[model samples]
Target chain A: MSSINSSGEPAAVRVVGGWASPFVNRVVVALKLKGVVHEMLQETVGKKSELLLRSNPVHKKIPVLLHHGKPIAESLIIVEYIDEVWASNGAPAILPRDPHGRAVERFWAQYIDDKIPPGIRVLRGSVAQDKDKAAGEMSTALQHLEEAFVECSQGKQYFGGDNIGYLDIALGSFLGWIKAVEKIAGVELLNEAKVPNLAAWADRFCAHPAVVDVVPDADRLVEFTVQHAALLRAVNVPK
Target chain B: MSSINSSGEPAAVRVVGGWASPFVNRVVVALKLKGVVHEMLQETVGKKSELLLRSNPVHKKIPVLLHHGKPIAESLIIVEYIDEVWASNGAPAILPRDPHGRAVERFWAQYIDDKIPPGIRVLRGSVAQDKDKAAGEMSTALQHLEEAFVECSQGKQYFGGDNIGYLDIALGSFLGWIKAVEKIAGVELLNEAKVPNLAAWADRFCAHPAVVDVVPDADRLVEFTVQHAALLRAVNVPK
Candidate 1:
């Protein structure tokens, strides 16, 4: 943790996050890369802790990184804040120096944030006849995602080439949920046959030391999904 | 106007944008500020122009600024790109230079971006008996917003203080839309009696030379809303 100042103030980054949240994982990976130390508080979402409630009064969502009492909500925003505050030496810059490169990265990150949620909607919609429609939408979204990776990466190992960047973090959060949806729906969105580059990128990302250490256990995630998938499906089914 | 590059190419930053989009207006303001010369192309949303479709196939959204043949999409991302590329000597930096100041600015900007749309939901839920319910939600949102602005500006004239930064530009594009909604909805969200600082801030932002020059014409916007409000109302009406 070279980022810590000599005064031993702990560099003051406390993440109010949940255990199963992939969004929280993105922030965790970023903090780890920055060599910053902080307490990680696992929040109960439906019954938000009083501290979480006070820290993020507006959204009341998890992954709120409270730095010295001021909370920064939204996982991506917190990641950027970590990068700015820690000023890591020789660590991967989450954004590119080239203006164009930065835009491309942010563009994909925003797209994933906005559009990929529809796939989650569809995944939740599975098990009803309406599930079929949601499944179709998910398929289309995955196809578009495949095309995006093919175009953006060209031949690079990551969105930023050789090393993962913001887009990688943004997109990587989906892998666990996506895999769970694939199992629940009996379909595969990230078939290597269709999106080899994205699949490879996912592999490289999962292998990264920072990512490997922080990601929630895959077997536990799968078991949890298997338990909860039924209720989620029932709720999303049109009455 | 001081940002003419050494290439002597009509300062040739190219913009792929659409009319009638607030996101595109963000880029337009930044370019006008730096006096950067740019070639503009209007690209459609559902059916993009060949150039845009090819250049920004990943997101397939407009407001992609091309500099030296590279494309940058998403509005905020483009704003940052423009700021980085065209920032002249002694001109106000769109983003704050101090890490803490930057973090605070970004926090509110993200807050506004995430939460303000729901505040405008009053415009949507007007016809139903639950219209009052929607208005209540709007009021709560506004109250939160009042606190946010107080915290954001404190004694400063702008989020960046005295100088219009990214937060101002980001919020400015929406002020016209908010005013338009207020008129049709017959409710004032930013009444001076309630949100005096924010109301004054909005007034100052609209009067800023860069903002005044680049914002869409009020009359045209009013006319556009008159024709479109009916369609919006129909979309939001309860079944």
Candidate 2:
């Protein structure tokens, strides 16, 4: 785990997020990594607060970071905001310094953001979600990420090298969801045999101090998935 | 116009792009704004180049920027890359200087990136595209952008305020396709009467020298769309 550089002002930073959300976890863990003390405003699913709606008028989604008076929505964007606001607050840098390195981070973060949970949603999703295609995409994306791990990690501890950086926080936040999905799907995405490095990386990432509390417990997620699937089955009558 | 601080060497910059792509237009225009001359390696729709396949193996898509032999894929990410590498090169900044302002730029640029063409795609799309939902979303999103234009522009000419910034390049690149889709669908998405400010902004944005050569001609796009639609109609027979 990277040591905290400077203790940020706790009162100044706040996150409107749900406890179970991997998206929300990205913002939260990023803040913690920066040593920024923040308050979490728990948001319930299916109901958006005035703060969220105003903060993100377009999507009205959770994980809106309210710094001082302004609201920044979207998890990855919010994490980038945290990195910039505290660029020098001295906790290890979230983004790399060089332009190319930064762009590479953005690319992979985007890849994870766009592909995932959507990629794994099929395990818990209704019949309409297309399990075959989602499974195929997940399989391919995992292989790519496995190769990316070899390249980005460079035999270091994390995507950020010796410490956690942007891609780490980006994909690390989803570890619980991935685990739950794997359990539900009866598949090994980050398999020890197939993606040994990624599987090992997931273990190291989850054990990090910055991550432990932010990411939901995999077992809890599994329970939630089962219940959610049951509820969906009840609600979704055959067309 | 933001004067170029340095004439970045043309030899170092090469773009793998297709002529008719709005995504490609964004990267091209951003480089132009930076006063960086570049070579365009044209790519056909059906065939993927060895260069492209090598550079962006995952999706194998175009609009990959090759700088000093390194590859950067995805248009918005490439534009951000351009902004970062040439940050001091005297181009009007694509992203803003302050963290909050930069976040705002990223938020809206993403809003534009995520919404558009997808929002408007229904107009030029096949049967599966939900016209009503898309049209409704477009109507709402345009209103949001219209309002955002007022806020971001602050009575100035562009989203970047006085000079074209990230959001301007992100959205402006699509004007050609927007016009073509309008011509095909007989709809006014950027309606002057409805969104006077955005409508006016679009006209002004297209006239910018950086944009003129890059964005494909609206009439040409219209011709392409007509041909493409006819081809699709012929191929997809009561599947």
Candidate 3:
């Protein structure tokens, strides 16, 4: 840990993240859950900051955590790093203490990362042909996630049992996006009839005080989607 | 850990892997490095086994480590699980003991996973248009990896300082494929002048006892690539 700055704040803790990115939101939720005091630096998409590029030269992506002048990239990796560094800081454990349990959590978190992007593309696609094809792919991805929730949750409020854990934070950050996508695509992704447990889980996750404070405003995110509709269409041209 | 079978062997330690898969090879190298007595269950690429599907229902992917009848999927995650479970079995540490060092190792291992597949696609592309585009993408990816070696290795014999570690196992498993791809594409990917450190790193990695024992024979891998050339070309068609 680095010493406090002249302003009497933790000098080492800083995060470069985008306003509407689920990946960035994951990191923000983790930091708040861990009770770490940090400054958030906003980086816009299509125009990344020099700091972000320098910090993450390989990917030049956001959600890079700068701790004591060192940068760590990738959202899940950053969350895991936060968990390990702040393990003794009196916060709830993000990952289970046991090795096997931790492995299970990691498996699901990776699963979410693997599956969600296709769904996002489907929602953002302006062409009917692309949207239909992506819808089928996204459906299969969501079905797998639903099965995972049933198996891993075991009827608990969160994947970490009583408290929200790694997979919860990983997937929970997407609730607002899921809503925005549903509106844009005119389709339901997590309907109560189709994925009841996951629907409840999303509601509970979004309602958490720590998460609520950090997540982007839903109406603004929806508005952001509409504002960027043409850009999304151009990026998601039928393939 | 589970009890031994009637033969007094660790009956539960088994890996479902494919001979030609770099992902599968990563798991094999880790098992051998940790000195874990495990059985290797071979799987064909297109014709996946029922056992593999049953073990890993979510992904249905190979390199699933079956420990005590429990299945763990995804190569990197499985390697981490093996490291943690066998930590006390007198094997070399796969990840650095310090949290920050471990994070750095994880980041690069992930970088390799994210970047190498696209390079492989470029090498396998049959169409000139696709190949030309893929070549530029592959070059950029390789350059980033070259820089990574310079930054992380620091003139050491391995990324793990004096010995092999997580990133070493993760990237080293692709050695045979790299050789085969270079031959197939008629291009140099890791030449001494281009990426000297990584070139030396690859040579050291391939010569290591653990890696040598598990990596598929170089000649056989080249033959495999030749046999599957059409399939590879079809899959790599500009997507």
Best by DockQ: 2
Residue pairs in candidate 3 whose N, alpha carbon or C atoms collide under 3 angstroms: none
For model 2, how big is the iRMS in angstroms? 0.8
What is the iRMSD of the candidate numbered 3?
A: 1.0
Clashes of each: 2, 0, 0
TM-score of each: 0.84, 0.90, 0.91
| TM-score preference between candidates 1 and 3, better one | 3
Q: Write one digit per residue (lDDT tens) for candidate 1, span A161-220.
A: 666777778888777667666676667777888677777777888888878867655566
* Residue A28 local lDDT, model 2: 86
Expressed as tens digits, the lDDT of each residue in A1-239 for candidate 2 is 22222664445677888777888888889988888777888875556788888877777777788888588887888888888888887688888888889888899888987787676666656455777677778777877888888888899989889999999998898889888777777766777898888899999999999899878877988876666665544533100
CAPRI grade of model 1: medium
Q: Which residue runs does candidate 2 get wrong by more than 4 Å?
A: A1-10, A130-133, A227-239, B1-10, B126-133, B228-239
Q: Which digits, one per residue and each the tens of the lDDT, describe model 1 over residues B1-239?
A: 33445776633578877555667778888777766667777653335588887877765666778887777777788888888876665567888776666666666666666655555545634344454565566556556666766776667888667777887877777776567656656677778897777788888888888777666654655666566556545543111
Ranking by DockQ: 2, 3, 1
Off by over 4 Å in 3: A1-5, A8-10, A126-129, A230-239, B1-10, B125-129, B230-239
What residue pairs clash in candidate 1, if any at all? B1-B34, B1-B35
- Candidate 3 CAPRI assessment class: medium
